[model samples]
Target: MTGVPASAAGGTGAKRVPAPKGKLGAAAVNQASLWNIANILTMVRLVLVPAFVVLLFQDGGYDPAWRAWAWAAFAVAMITDVFDGHLARTYNLVTDFGKIADPIADKAIMAAGLISLSVLGDLPWWVTSVILVREIGITLMRFWVIRLAVIPASRGGKAKTLAQGVAVGMYVLALTGPLATLRFWVMALAVVLTVLTGLDYVRDAVVIRRRAIVALRVAEAEAGAVEDSGASGDSASDEAGESAAAESTR
Candidate 1:
């Protein structure tokens, strides 16, 4: 048998794959540049957590000077949290990475600070426990639903963060002598706000969960329909081929 030409065999007939297109390509590009200002702030918050821990435990066990430094570090971290969002919204720099990292950073710092203080006997264990449970629970919930729909931070969530920051700050300041009673009162108000905000987050989570369930069901139904349509098309093409074969035989 004559040898097949190289071009006919494989040289020039190979298909050229086109570059990626549409929303998938766009999403890939977006994901590639996920790091931004908000993410940087989140990283800063994470870094401050260890510093706060060291100040609370290793460096200067709730001493006035150390406490002041701790408070300042915490304040700066919290301030970055606020500014990151402001910059993200104002400058249109919001990214999926920022959305994920910001809350995680908040929870990490708050948990570290609260846990350290509780260990040091500054904060009551029950109070820290409640806050920690809520924070951790909500964070898990957020992760579970993140793939379906992004749950933006609610107003109550923001208030909760503010209350926590203020309360923790006052508690740290209380380590110093000046205005100890005033700081105690401030902390009490912060506690009240914290409780209210916690409840609000619970309510918001319930709504988000319900919405996520609905979205999931809708997506599943759509996917199933597409699969069924594809199967039907395959069946029709097979039937058409059989009919053509019969006609040729006839």
Candidate 2:
């Protein structure tokens, strides 16, 4: 009761509560729906991945025409990744499902494309292996680190994605004779960006781990202090009540 205001006491003198605005109204709107345009885009991206893989591996060879189609599909899927997040923020369409599904879809599409390209001998297996390992490792790290800190996409990560897109697109185009020479250059750029971005991610994970340890220690200290304070307060209150009762009896 020491911390409680007089108005909060059970009495007729209580003041009327003020009408809530802004965030309260926004929260009401947020609770109304979970589906939105961003989620639709994510679903579309997921649907496109299989079709793109089919195109990439059709006819037991990388047919130039199918490769072209695959490139288009991959490009569209990548664009949807960007658009989905943008639409989510712009339209306030964020949802837990969207957050979960979006990354899964992205990883699936990337894995399919990379594996197909590696199988087709369009890109070096070593390059794909390194990229795949980094992607999977970082994803797992993200899950672990999220308990303590947020891991938003860094600029280097975006650049790495762009580099991969260009590399894959060029590799697909290389199925046609005219673009074959450019494929190696694009892939080389991609490899460089991938290695740098992977290192950056590893560094970020280390920092996140350190921060998480610190956060856990701080949280434990705070919880212990709260428990100590609560116990002391209760003991003191009991003694005061006993003293008052003894005085009244006397």
Superposition error at 7 for model 2 (Å):
26
Worst 10 residues of 2 by lDDT: 23-32
Model 1 Cα lDDT, one tens digit per residue, 78-130: 89988887866665566877877787787788887788778878888988888
Clashing pairs in 2: none
lDDT of 2 by residue, 110-204 (tens): 88878888887777799889888988888998888787788788898898888887777777653555567677777788778888887887788
Show where candidate 2 strays beyond 4 Å.
1-35, 175-179, 233-250
Clashes of each: 0, 0
Q: Find the candidate with the highest lDDT and give its number.
A: 2
Candidate 1: TM-score? 0.67
Q: How much lDDT does each candidate structure score?
A: 0.76, 0.82
Error of 2 at 68 (Å): 1.2
